[model samples]
Target: MKIKNRTLLLPLAAVLCVAALTGCTRTSYAIQTNDARTIISDGKPKEADSGLLEYTDANGVKQQISKTEVKQVTELPK
Candidate 1:
């Protein structure tokens, strides 16, 4: 009984560790606009409560752009 429990615990611990590490990882994204502008953000861009796509740029600047101005949003590979 003890050996069986230990074997199960090892895999469980490994899975939990993997999940925790991945959870901490964030994906960057490239936001393109109709005006030929590109913005890189740390995470996925989301619409603000005020109806604007708000995110922090790679330059560490806070930006709030309207949805009408955006052409597309693409996730950048790690």
Candidate 2:
């Protein structure tokens, strides 16, 4: 009886471990607005499916970064 229980529990434990590892990873992104406002964009923003932040530097060059890949974000004084 104990042997049969162990056999059943082993498979269930493996499935639970796999499910936890493959679960969606949540991330946060800092968006620098056009008006110099900073915001955190987690979900898909209007037009972008990846919830990426868009901004232009002093040179007027556009740049974008996805929320998922952003480990951390910091703002510097202009």
Candidate 3:
């Protein structure tokens, strides 16, 4: 019983470690709008409660833009 438990624990621990580290990787994104303004986001944008598109800027600041203004969203190069 002890050996079986120990065997399972190693793989379980490894999986948990991998999952923990996975969240550390952040992908930046670029939001192209109808206007000439270029928006760089720290991560994927989300729809806020006010119905505006909310995203974290490259400077770590939170910003919101109207949905109508967004032309396209593309993942930036890593």
lDDT per model vs. reference: 0.91, 0.57, 0.92
Question: Where does model 3 exceed 4 Å of error?
Answer: 1-23
- Which digits, one per residue and each the tens of the lDDT, describe model 2 over residues 1-78? 999999999999999998997675434445554555665544333335668756454444556766555454554332
After the best TM-score superposition of candidate 2, give how far the Cα of residue 72 lies from its true spot, in angstroms.
Answer: 15
20 Cα displacement, candidate 3 (Å): 7.9
TM-score of model 3 vs. true structure: 0.65
Of 2 and 3, the candidate ranking higher by TM-score: 3
Task: State the weakest 10-residue window (summed lDDT) of model 3.
Answer: 43-52
Clashing pairs in 1: none
- lDDT per residue (tens digit) for residues 1-78 in model 1: 999999999999999999999999888999999999998998888898887999888876888899999999999999
RMSD to truth, every model: 4.2, 11.6, 4.5
TM-scores, all candidates, are 0.64, 0.33, 0.65
Error of 1 at 51 (Å): 2.2
Tell me how far candidate 3 lies from the true structure as C-alpha RMSD in angstroms.
Answer: 4.5
The candidate maximizing TM-score is: 3
In terms of lDDT, the poorest run of 10 residues in model 1 is: 55-64
Q: Model 3, 9: alpha-carbon shift in Å?
A: 23
